[model samples]
Target: MADDSHLRETPLSRTELLRGHFLHVVRDTVRMPDGAQATREFVLHPGAVMVIGLLDDGRVVMERQFRHPMQAVMIEFPAGKLDAGEGSLACAQRELLEETGYSAREWAFAGRLAPTIAYSDEVIDIWFARGLTLGERRLDEGEFLDVFAATPAELQAWCFSGEVIDCKTLIGSMWLQNVQRGEWVLPWAASPGGADAGESGT
Candidate 1:
């Protein structure tokens, strides 16, 4: 097996552009594998957090909200953008409570995903939230959503029925299912006898 410590990583030189309401543009100069050079444009983001909140009975909590860009209501896991200087786990807890009126006793980092790589540098941090307990929901001033819980089969049906259309939610739900089935593990949680690579559900 290849020595994990010897793997090469991408190195880039970047310049920041427009920094506005939760968005920033960055220009990157990267070295090509063929000993060439190239420039890549990326929208630097603060990243995001998603919660796969599993209830005590094994159902997963989900939210239905209208996405302005898609112009449609979609079922999605509770999620929110990371505030500047906020931790991903913290964001997960906040979003879960605010959007679904639920809090979990156990939280684990499931994995990360890049929803859009072609035009943005966004890395979404996914977390698994279990041992859930109901609480008072606190929605944002203009936010509106309907919350529900579903089993794996129900969620799958919703996905195929066009009820759950958000890419991130679909990926997070599948990741949660695989994790529960022992088919996935976080890189940091891997041991000598476990999978050592990071798995991307995207």
Candidate 2:
């Protein structure tokens, strides 16, 4: 089937709005599809990764941390932004260990997600880890969060009750449900630091 045509906006000018420690904001003036000029603002973000740390007894490792911008504490999977030149799988493994103190012998590249496509260029790679061993967390200096585990049923209830409202985690829960029910399949591979299999979209 042929897809409908897309509307392409042409950039007339762009101005650097702000450059912060992690976020780079920009404003662009563009010629819209209908030929009217308008300004659009957005942030450029370094990509990140999230890990669904599955244990042997059907629980998932997770975290609770406060986000200043949201003015609320959020429940999330073990996740972090990429360093200057980190691979997605490497970042996922590093973040999982750093935040939760667990390492896996088996890993799967579940998918990627754009949590906020309307105003930011942010992509989060999602991964699943199993065959677990636990150790001390190696959190970054100044980072503070509590790590815990929850059953899939508990997570689903949290989502339905508005307790867990993070977009990425909700997507993770969907993936968990589908995979557990044999409706979705993931390509499993050796743990991180080994050769990474290519990622697929959910």
Candidate number with greatest lDDT: 2
Residue by residue across 8-97, what tens digits does model 2's lDDT show?
788899999999887899999999888899999999899999999899999999899999989999999888898887788778777877
What C-alpha lDDT, on a 0 to 100 scale, does residue 108 get in candidate 2? 90
Predictions in order: lDDT? 0.76, 0.86
Clashing pairs in 1: none
The residue-level lDDT of candidate 1 at 35 comes to 53
Q: Which residue segments of model 1 deviate by more than 4 Å?
A: 1-17, 29-38, 185-202
Instruction: Evaluate model 1: give its TM-score.
Output: 0.77
Task: Report the lDDT of model 1 for residue 122.
Answer: 86
